[model samples]
Target: MIVAIAHSRAQLGISAPAVRIETHLTNGLPAFNLVGLPETAVRESKERVRSAILSSGFEFPSRRITVNLAPGDLPKEGTRYDLAIALGILAASGQIPHAPLGDFEAVAELALTGELRGVRGVMPAARACQQASRSLIVAPDNVLEATRVRGVQVLPAATLSALCGHLKQTQRLAWAAPAPPYAHSNLAGQPDLAEVRGQYFAKRALEIAAAGGHNILLYGPPGTGKTMLATRLAHLLAPLDDEQAYEVAAIHSIAGLHRAPGQWLVPPFRAPHHTSSAPALVGGGSTPRPGEASLAHHGILFLDELPEFGRRVLDVLREPLEIGRVTIARAAGTVDFPARFQLVAAMNPCPCGYHGDPGASCRCTPEQVRHYHSRVSGPLLDRIDIQIEVARERNWLSSTVTAQLESSASVRARALAARARQWARQGKINHHLSVSELSLHAPLDRPTEKFLAHAFEHYRLNPRTYHRLMKLARTIADVADCPAIAQDHLSEALALRRLEVAPAWPAGMKH
Candidate 1:
């Protein structure tokens, strides 16, 4: 045979798009050519393919060789194509039959010794191959990740010679077994809520946030346990469902992150440093990799020392917070990554970390405090559903009165019940409810409506704040297992909007 074709996939964002590997051999001077807009890594695959074929005891054709990755305009990158290119060359040279290549898709890097090596983003390729109804061939190291996609036939190949033997019907590669059924015991361990000392109000706000998938900001003095409260919020939330787990796993795979066994179902908790750049926070680069926001999909993104981050860096998250996705456009193309993360942020009240504390004397002038608060933008504050203060626990160590605090399991039970109600009523969490859906699911009675309107008018709340307050109220009511939004629910929701209040030192700080 003078020509042969093999199938493969290319990673774009979290998606795997099909790429056809076509190889042709002609009677001419011995030379090799590769086309189709391949990037540096892919272009280097030619040498790796040549070495692998020779090392595998296969004849290398001396005729002129040409390889093309079809759909020429689509840019391809990575070493994933090495295996496919080698298989194509062997088939075209009559070393392996070309007929068996049609039923399978190959995605693996080839070593100089003809061994197969795992590549990043194999989970997405496995899913795409499953959808296309084709079996997937991958290295043994990647067998577990590929088998995670249910119903996908994964054939693990340790070396090029082994795979060729399978293709020639002389040897058969065993199908990889599917992953075991997920159990509740396999959930990732998290710090218990009981570990935190006092601050019942902060705990309450965390419960409400977890119940409705709402974004929360905890602001107080330096030693007030704001970070502690933010970290415990994820544990109060339910575990990810199968589809959500798969999505999270695929995103992690694309980012070259590996989760320990039994951690797949756990919601991700990403805490990026305050010095992280905008692209690091929102997922951008020349190649457009998944950023921290996308890494936190279906989970919590906790930003400690929130104001310490650059204003522009924080602003880059506004669009993803509103739309549940981040769209990064580069010179080549635009890529969208799922960024539906539950934001949990922690910050101090002022530059000195004690603006309103009665215990500490004010060290800075009001201007410094004002400037510190202004670093966080108003629009970004508006998108946060809950903003509560974590006051210092006075005489925390002096008093030894031991009393059992609420545990994470009990709080999670309540949170799960509330989420169940939300899913049954609207097929989504309260924070994701649309304005129209709010009218139907979160209706207010006459007196409650009047109370909410009076609060809105008094606070000069914008439409976005008003709607978010309604969602918060709906979540509070759900946690209480109430069918309707009561006046007290609205009152508590309004109280949680601490940033909306104008303080003396931090003047002009209003959501």
Candidate 2:
């Protein structure tokens, strides 16, 4: 007899349609064989299936049993196939009826005593099952995560025996309804923007960055609240919509970092340490997974102490920053992860941290200062849309002033209004606008056009940097509620770009 059960495996960014698990009893020496390019985890599921069958008081067939994961060309990984394999063997041996197994997509990792364990990427698997119009049988531990996807009949199984009992009509498992997703509130653990004591210029730049989904770089001496301000940017972002929530949650579940009992509603804030490797920051493994950048998708990626990281590691992010996705090609195949994130990086002016500080004198030589700043490549700096220098002032922090600054909630309200206006004017946000779209929507007025032409010649700006400056100016215009980008907007945008001018190369080194 041969018994086949249906399952699924995630490939690239989506779940492949279906993988049928078939167990056949054939005449040969007593041994078990698994086929269909099963990875080590899938192959190892055999021992677990055997132990679980016997420990659950089911007979293990003595004949040579060959288990084949159908659609043989498809590469299968993970312990997700354990339950399907076990059920196929049981139904082949005629212990459990095959009719019930045919209706549901069974996915779980089984222990020797038949206890079902949780598996990764359950959210995506559940969604796939729903799309296929099939029921999902998940381990009790995974039910919490799986229930995040609605419109699916979720049967949470405690153990393999429990599933068998239910399928055989001896007992039944309870159905789990979808869990309501939770939204992150500005009043929660988040710090308010009003708490930032000073640096109004930096605060305004933060507003523009959040409004346009632009990347920002803050260069200043130590203790200027660059890190402090970056942390509050998420609070300024509007809450994720339902579809965006599920997308973010699904990525987190696959990464095994989903928050318990609730979903992430607000944009996620990921601050990977400077010591993170290229793989850890960008994401890769034997089985490629979402890295920090992808995990920060639809959210913020904050890098403090920017120049301290490996130049190569920082360089790895340039491609994703441009394309909004990261592709990791392996022997298995190519897996692409979403890398659309707003980047906020902070750095010191020099190695000694006092190059331009009004509060202190610099010790580093000119060459040393140049080397320290040069660690950040020109190409990377060009990608950053807004750049600002934070100069220290103690008056804002003094006891005499008690006036309140705008809270994150207030700032977010203005930001949402600005975003709605921009999106309505252009189909997408300002940051996503292409060159053609920019020409149509942000056509510069005569005065602004003349100002940009003069600045381009004086500052020696490249075409890429010119586009970035115009985009930033468009964002500023959006926030100002102006019908057309004006000369002041272009002037302000150019001021930000000129804040940190890269060192001029030696006479012969100019490209």
Number of the predicted model whose lDDT against the real structure is largest: 1
**Tens-digit per-residue lDDT, 1-511, candidate 2:** 5655646554445343478887888777888888885557655787888899999889998888888887876656757788888888888778899887778897788887899988777888888888888899988888888887878779998888888899899997789977874645445556888888878888888898888888998878898888999898888887887777777777788787775543367788899999999999888987778888888888999999999988889998998899988998778677888888999999888888888676799998888877777778777777888888776877887765437777888788778888998889987889999999999999987777998898888767766777888888898898899979998898888766645334432111112
Model 2 CA lDDT for position 435: 94
Best by TM-score: 1
lDDT of 2 at 162: 84
Off by over 4 Å in 1: 185-189, 398-401, 460-463, 502-505
TM-scores, one per candidate: 0.95, 0.95
Error of 2 at 147 (Å): 0.5
Clashing pairs in 1: none
Clashing pairs in 2: none
- Clash count list over all predictions: 0, 0
